[model samples]
Target: MDSYELAIRNTVEVVTEDELKELLKKPEKSVYTGYEPSGEIHLGHLVTINKLMDLREAGFKVKVLLADLHAFLNQKGDMEKVRELAEYNRRCFEAVGLKGKNVEFVLGTDVELNPEYQLNVLKLAQQITLNRATRSMDEVGRNMDAPHVSQMVYPIMQMVDIHTLGVDLALGGIDQRKIHMLAREYLPSIGAKTPVCMHTPILNGLNGKKMSSSEGNYISVADTEDNIRKKMKKAFCPPEIEENPVLQVLKYHVFPRLDSITLRRPEKFGGDREIISYGECETSYAKGEIHPADLKSACTEGLIEVLAPARDYLGL
Candidate 1:
């Protein structure tokens, strides 16, 4: 596929396809995705990381923000703990292959605390209504029923981050679309150019429900091979192709990194088969050409292989 295709594949939406195409033509393009530091970097985070890799291949300078301050504002943890998580999160990101000269890792406090950033944030905060800010953060903010004042400032600060980073495009999961839309609408008013926003789908947890940390329904990069096998064994992989968590793993996580996936089986059960593309794998499963057990096994193996580099980097 071409550069533009690579940049957009598996994405749920690009705010304006025309805008992204235009930006791709420019010689020095940059894109960024911000992550609030968490205890573990799971498959949900990998979706954007994979997209970042694609962008890097497409010749865009990539920026990953370890939003420690944002995590604190979102009530994730105390300041010291959040900052600690940010450092570990950066190492996790690099372990998963988001490193290199073209890729940059920035701490949220490093830039967000600067006078110019704070000034712009305050300037924009004055114009955005409290209700608008709260609504923009509906999907991202934690415990919004009784939100702290810091939560309200989160979205506005995020808008200013686009300008502070000086990136041409902003990449995030679909859950962040509301906040990104807020940025597109308000940043231009602050003299910053409108940002091209790209969003990827949020994959369901292994249980077929929303991916949640408390539920332990997601797979983290730090999972051992046995852990992956155990998780896949229990994953909710329905026969139907749509919304199949295992197939989603193959499509979003596996195929993006591996050229092909082989499903090994006994000779009596259609023997071993090599699937060249996600579409083919999906079709075979839909037609009963591949069984759920076989598909899960293949996905488990593929994930193990894909994460081997990370495991090695982490000495796991």
Candidate 2:
């Protein structure tokens, strides 16, 4: 499929398809996606990472920034633990088949203080007024009342990532849309081409809320097979409810072919069934056409099978 179709199917929120197509045509242009190393890497992180790899395969030079400084700025914790988390997160990425010379992994603190970097940040900050930066904080989980000077300057530094790196596109979760907007608004004033922004859908937790580590509802990238299986088994998958979050998780991460194999429940699996996609599974359950227990078992088995390699690589 072409870039436009890919963006549509992937739920990438963007300003215009023409701009994305233009950037995709320029194979030499680079792109960036970053995450603050505040805690264990979760499935949500994987969605964005996989998207970055997809872009890399599409011929864009991709950079994955480990936001160590941003972590310090946002999450309060022991410095040693935060540092450990950063290294561990890096290994997790490598374990999940995301590495090599093409993908650049750099720490946020390492580059945030460079004179040239600071200069670019200041210039970008000047382009965007304080009022605009305040509005963008909602995307990053900061409230207007909680704005630190660093928080206000955060988007500027992010914009500098696009400027200094000469990136033509920025990939982020839907949450980072505002920050990328700031980049689009500010980068041009600094003489750099405004980077096109692309975002993937946010994955929901098993409990039908945002997957959050603090809420104790998240499945980490390093979860063990038994843990993963247990979590899936105990998750809330009601047959009459169509918007089952557990099913959503499966649809998002597990391979589509695996979903077909599990859903169909071919005679090999003790039943002759035909489950095509996640939507079908949900519809069947909601209509009282299929057993919830059976669907949960199929989803658990499918998720375990798909994540087994990643679990092993993480030594979980």
Candidate 1 C-alpha lDDT tens digits along 1-316: 9999999999999989999999889999999999999999999999999999999999899999999999999999999999999998999999999998899999999999989899999999888999888898888889989999999999998889899999999999998999999899889888999999999999999999999998999999999999999999999989888888999999999999999999999999989999999999998899999999999999999999999999899889
Measured against the true structure, the TM-scores of the candidates, in listed sequence, are 0.99, 0.87
What number of clashing residue pairs does each candidate have, in the order they appear?
0, 0
TM-score of candidate 2 to 2 decimals: 0.87
How high is the lDDT of residue 264 in model 1?
A: 98
Residue 296 miss distance in model 2 (angstroms): 2.3
Q: What is candidate 2's lDDT per residue for 259-280, written digit by digit as tens?
A: 4735445455457575766677
TM-score of candidate 1 on Cα atoms, chains taken together: 0.99
Candidate 1 residues lying further than 4 Å off, grouped into runs, are: none
Q: Model 2 segments beyond 4 Å from truth?
A: 1-4, 78-81, 142-144, 238-243, 256-259, 264-288
